[model samples]
Target: MSLELNINAAIKTAMLAKAEADLRALRAIKAAILHAKTAEGFSGELSEADETKLLQKLAKQRKDSLDIFRQQNREDLAAKEEEELVVIEKYLPKMMDEAELKAAIEAIIAQTGASSPADMGKVMGVATKQLAGKADGKAISGLVKELLAK
Candidate 1:
């Protein structure tokens, strides 16, 4: 089944199970999908890459909110954001571990022949397109810097 279908099914399941938190997160996802479809300049069809990007964006938003809530000592809100984050993560690709990330970055660096920090932009351009959902931007940037500095 497609990602959109899976999300809709999950929403129905959540509703039937009366899972409040799950339902809330699922609805949020569905809303995001619909919004994406209707956004100006969008082609009204989301590719796998687009879906992954959307899910990642949603997860990031929740994580940011989670951090803010924690800093404010708002356990109640933090708990809710955490719950949403868990649900949002279900649709995202598994993140690369440090070792896997290192290997991939090494390969990208080798392929790009990027040497020194001056070539960081060249390396990042390729890495961002290739890595996408597999890794976070910050982690990728740090690893690229570490590898290129070598």
Candidate 2:
């Protein structure tokens, strides 16, 4: 089934269960999907990869908000952002763990012949394309720097 169908089912479940946080998150996702469909030059359809990207963006937004809320000592807002992040992440592809990410980046560096920090751009270009939603860019960049400096 498509993400829209899955979200719809989850919305029904959330509504039935009277889950406020879940319901709110589901509606936010639904709104994003609708917006993407109607956005100019979007062709009114989202491929699986596009859906994954959208979900990842939403998850990232929630994470940033959660951090800000925590820093501001707003536990209530932070809790809400955390709940939304959980819902958004349910639709994203599983992220690579550190070891797996390191191995993948190492292979990418070897492929691109990236020997030092000077070749970061070369390594990053390939790694970002290959990993896409599998890992965070910041994490990949940090690992690449650590590995290449050795």
Best candidate per TM-score, number? 2
| lDDT tens per residue, model 1, 32-122 | 9999999998785799999999999999899999999999999999999999999999989899999999999899888988879899999
Candidate 2 residues lying further than 4 Å off, grouped into runs, are none
What ranges in model 1 sit over 4 Å off?
A: none
Cα lDDT, all candidates = 0.92, 0.92
Cα lDDT tens digits, model 2, 21-51, are 9999999999999999999887856899889
TM-score of each: 0.93, 0.97
